[model samples]
Target: MCEIFSKILQVPINHIKPIDYVPAAAAVNRPYDCHLSNNQLINLGININCIGFEDWWKNYLNN
Candidate 1:
């Protein structure tokens, strides 16, 4: 989820890189996965701003 991390860390999309392992929560501040699906969707022109649970909550509350 580069989009999620970009939103969380306040960084640009290209700044995120794929990792082979999911870092421990303590190290990363939250569990993260390096699935390629999100990247694929982005390449396909699908805007994915809410891929994770926290984003879902934010969207729900905002609505």
Candidate 2:
């Protein structure tokens, strides 16, 4: 997933960092958070390879 995001962001894969958070898996719900959009990716200099991005982007969305 980091590889995919890194590619879209035009950044080195090693530069991608994951955010660690405890999920409310039992009862209490976690607070809602904003999601990343393609526009934001572009602003950050993403590539949008126009071939794999559509399918690859979904891989991280589930996380």
lDDT, candidate 2, residue 56?
51
Predicted structure 2: clash tally: 0
Candidate 2: stretches off by over 4 Å: 15-63
Q: Top model by lDDT, which number? A: 1
In order, the Cα lDDT scores of the candidates are: 0.69, 0.66
Ten-residue segment with the worst summed lDDT in candidate 1?
Answer: 26-35
- TM-score of predicted structure 1: 0.24
Summarize candidate 1's per-residue lDDT along 5-46 as a digit string, tens digits: 567667788755777786676464645775555888888999
User: Global lDDT for candidate 2?
Assistant: 0.66
lDDT of 2 by residue, 1-62 (tens): 66766656667866557767756674575578966568977889989666466465665555
